[model samples]
Target chain A: MGHGGGGALSGELTRHLFTPAYGNETLGGLGDSAVLPLPGARLAFSTDSFVVRPLFFPGGSIGDLAVNGTVNDLAMSGARAAYLSCAFILEEGVGLPVVGRIADAIGAAAAAAGVVIATGDTKVVEAGHGDGVYVNTSGIGLVPDGVDIRPQRAVPGDVVIVSGPIGLHGIAIMSVREGLEFGVEVESDTAPLGSLVEAMLAVTRDVHVLRDPTRGGLGTALNEIAAASGTGVALVERHVPVPEAVAGACGFLGLDPLYVANEGRLVAFVPRTEADAVLAAMRAHPLGTGAAVIGECVAEHPGMVVSRTGLGGTRVIDLPLGEQLPRIC
Target chain B: MGHGGGGALSGELTRHLFTPAYGNETLGGLGDSAVLPLPGARLAFSTDSFVVRPLFFPGGSIGDLAVNGTVNDLAMSGARAAYLSCAFILEEGVGLPVVGRIADAIGAAAAAAGVVIATGDTKVVEAGHGDGVYVNTSGIGLVPDGVDIRPQRAVPGDVVIVSGPIGLHGIAIMSVREGLEFGVEVESDTAPLGSLVEAMLAVTRDVHVLRDPTRGGLGTALNEIAAASGTGVALVERHVPVPEAVAGACGFLGLDPLYVANEGRLVAFVPRTEADAVLAAMRAHPLGTGAAVIGECVAEHPGMVVSRTGLGGTRVIDLPLGEQLPRIC
Candidate 1:
């Protein structure tokens, strides 16, 4: 039931299944979005389907995730999301009021992100054959000239910087799914990151790579970057930003914080020369208040990620074999 | 369970729920696709989710429909689809070979349609919580300059031409679902209509309105045009092309052929002056060999559709309340 988790199985499905079936250079890139050239401009295209259970969650709902998820994908490509196409799959017996609430939330989220819902579709499945609501949003964004960002751009001299704290979104959904709430409520950090990406680009278009650490969290994203660029990543564990509440929840749940998901946060790889200036720019943005540099790309142990422990020892951070939490946005 | 049947219920959902929730003119248009003005180009964007039961139908599977449906939507907007983003929701325990077959079909269909499947996503749901597979495809196409086609452009004296036969797709699905046979197997007429649309445009750019009669077939599509343009439509029942097998099946099944779905055919409203040439152009295309002039827009009895009976009497054709065959496409 968990075949699509963002891990080794997912990687095998893509490599041996989807990529070969597509048989094209575009899909082979396997980036968050695909960049297509038009008459006088470049367009970034991306698609994501949200199937999170319990339609409503802490600080966000499926509606909010549906919009922000695609918007953030475009942002990671250094594009300004301009339009979104939404499709909803509803169970037959679901109430109209519930659908209305979701539609309103999607609309509000699009407005907040400054993107228009250009087109949409709806299909209803028989009552027992489907879940309450599943949303698939595909976005089109304009990629400005000279702004080239991809996982392959990470180089040995580049420094890795995460926009803010991690693991809140994964933990938040787990808390609701398992009915285990900590003393402090951990709200999902689900906010649009387009403006923050724009601020970083404003500082310089030389941002090597930008990725929203979703699904398998910062650890998987880093491993992907390392494998795609044929470089190793070295991280200082103490420098990684983790909220006190999130850390406590992860510890109690016997989960590693690095493998938890974050919706609004991003990991950026910038040249060492532009790291300080870019960090300043990210800090100035509202969504990047906790911006921190916790890692750097290295030439040793290619396609690997290792973190320095507090005891002056280093341990390899393996990419998760499957998701710690399934059905996450 | 049949809420999205492309009938009155679907219309109400869009008008009362979706449009108001979106609160944008782009979505309010409610056309098959939305046209957005890009720098130096007009982009047509559309989305559709295919949840047809028994993934593999008689002539085509959900994979072909997923590609061609969105391609046809963009074609209706006077655009040739250039790119598509596909997302799949698979139920847990589904066989990999089955998924592989669907993927290969999608790739082949996109290649045949001359559009690239640029990006995609896949998610898995628990075994009993979902159907076998649900596919959502969002497409982007570039609209040619000086060609503007929309539902509202169906003015008085516009001649309506249908590309080919109808009702085959719906009957084919019904036969499989209900295990009924009428001595003849009805194969679905699923094919990409982008090239056919291009051929029609080559004859003239004055095609006023274009729609693929999918879920609610020709009756509902004609009604939507009449309502959107505030014009009446008059049709000759004898002129509407229906295959002999499809007619027999519909009769035995107690269904109206006018309300049965078709996947490949399109109904085009063109200026009276250019109607003959456009019909000739359409007939020359492989997919539109059975093209016929079925009706014309009239100024009298606005927002209504009436057809001349084969028995020399006139009858009003009411829009269906819901699909006679759910998940036909």
Candidate 2:
């Protein structure tokens, strides 16, 4: 039977997978929409779709990843996240228990982030018609006054900062999908960055650009900011943080850590004078304990991102023209 | 290649299947989101997903079907729709041209409704992984002040009115899927209802409940309204408009038109004293030219819906407990 059928199969998916992962006070009631109290501030809205393969990977499952991913995107926009709308596409034959765990994780993630799930939708596809599950979430948050940040706002001479380490999410997913094992566990860097973002925003309003190094990783994000702002970026290899396990995994797989994905970390571009204050604020947050100034914007080579290598060579970091790891979210 | 790749395969589907059926200005560009001007009112928002099978059917294609379906949902909320976001899931090996026509139809329908397509997403699945295409659309509309209406607001003595005939969309899809078309064409009555809704809101602010008879048809919508408002509904079969072709098809297929679906029609609940005025206003609109008084609310049988047949027999109309036609949106 198709997963969309309103029968035992569909019930299992909803009960086990969706409900547990995304369960919240409003979601527990299972109404058409989640009613939320409006807070005082301008709202910031964003939506993203996740199709990461190997539903359950080291350090996290798709359910938690979905929640954290959307939360982080909103955080980058300097918004205090409020509510989320979840829509799911499930394939027939997906075990109900797995779905339940995913739903549970989603619920846990939302709870940790202090946000509510307000509205949701579910659809089932034929077994062969879809991947195991695809989750699309749309979230809205309140953007406090005087916090204006956008990718295009990165300016020449601004200091670039990254919160904590990168590449754990990409490598963690790859390890599971490829059935490889490392002596030390490498979990996904999946966690809500709302608190850290809030801390940073509270410390300074001069944050010009904020982005999570997802799909294309730190390199791609830098390239995008540079292109969008019509400026160049220069990164110091030593300053950028990379967990040892993630770096080892990348090296073994012939992957560049710079091109890998990270869910919990974010890059911020701030005026040179405010960089230290922003870094200090980030370091105070548990998720951003390793925060450091990793790069600086440059007027030369507009729309380019160049990294100073550890061995004294400079390499231009460009966007991947095609999909690197399909279904890596 | 997932359908949401925003790449070649996705472009092909948009050109073939979506274009001819629902083409419109904002949809034509196929951008990230649709952008529309606020039409002098606060916004009303609604979203729906269509998983109807046999994507192409008599009278309409899923392309136009998806556009009008969502547009009508927004209209039912008494909003002057301004924008729509379309998301697609394509089964690999589905012909590209078919998808393109669907995209075109979406664009056309938005143009006809004076709405814009501000954002879109596409994902592709392996062959047999999906039924041909599933479209999810979210729409936003501007609602004028003093036009508060909801299903829970219906009261006893309120008159029930329907904009035009019922069951066209259901029969249209059924005829195609079952290959049992009637001699006369039974076209899916799929169309945008923003103009009709605007016309009604222009006449009176006393309208109480507005709903579209889509998936479970007129009976299901009425039952929902009755239950939501804690009131009973008495619908007269003779007063309900069912096109001859649709009626004949339903009889032949042993299907109840009351449980079928409609695309372009709506059911409005208004004060009995002002029923005539609301019907007159609805009739003035092009989409509601065939509008008629269908029934009235009653204090008896709270939360129940009963239909008085032409022969004087009455039967309870309730929500379908299970899928009548899988993937019928």
How accurately is candidate 1 docked according to DockQ?
0.82
How is the predicted docking of candidate 2 categorized under the CAPRI scheme? incorrect
Cα misplacement distance, residue A319 of candidate 1 (Å): 1.6
Q: Please, what are the lDDT tens digits per residue for candidate 2 over residues B126-220? A: 56666777777665555666776778789999999999999888887777777785998777888888788888877788788888877668877
TM-score of each: 0.99, 0.82
Off by over 4 Å in 2: A1-43, A93-99, B1-43, B56-63, B90-101, B120-128
Chain A TM-score of candidate 2 vs. true chain A: 0.86
lDDT string for model 2 (A42-77, tens) is 445555556677888888888887788778877877
| Model 1 segments more than 4 A misplaced | none
In model 2, what is the error at residue A84, expressed in angstroms?
Answer: 2.3
Question: Lowest-lDDT window of 10 residues in candidate 2 chain A?
Answer: A29-38
Angstrom error at residue B86, model 2? 3.5
TM-score leader: 1
- Winning model by lDDT: 1
Per-residue lDDT for B15 in model 2? 49
In angstroms, how far off is B202's CA in candidate 1? 0.3
